[model samples]
Target: MKDLIKAINGHLAAEFQASHTYLAMSIWLRKKDLAGFSSYMLAKSNEERGHASRMIAYLVDSDETVELPT
Candidate 1:
């Protein structure tokens, strides 16, 4: 169970980082006036955040102490 929690946290951390990258790309695209691409990337970033939230919630509900990745 501890191992599972650790793995989940690790995955979430990676996902969160990915969200950051996506957001950056979105901002850049918006600056370039590519609204469509920017919106798509922004949506993808939101999805990643949602996934991280789900991972955290699952770990907490499973009675695991989830240490959010640094």
Candidate 2:
């Protein structure tokens, strides 16, 4: 259970980073006047959020403790 929790948290951390990356890309694309590219990056960010949420739900179902460290 502990390992599973750790894995989930790791994935969550990665997703968090990816979100930041995509967000930055979107802003950059906007400044470049590429609305389509910006939208694409935003979509990718949403997908990462979904992936992390699934892992989190699985960990919770397994009765593992999930913590977000600041």
Top candidate on lDDT is 1
lDDT (CA) per prediction = 0.90, 0.82
Q: How does residue 40 of candidate 1 score in lDDT?
A: 100
Worst 10 residues of 2 by lDDT: 61-70
Model 1, 1-70: lDDT tens per residue?
Answer: 6787788888988989989999999999999999999999999999999999999889888888777767
TM-scores of all models?
0.92, 0.85
**lDDT tens digits, residue span 42-67, model 2:** 89888887887887787778788766
Provide the lDDT at 58 for model 2: 79
- Off by more than 4 A, model 2: none
- Candidate No. with top TM-score: 1
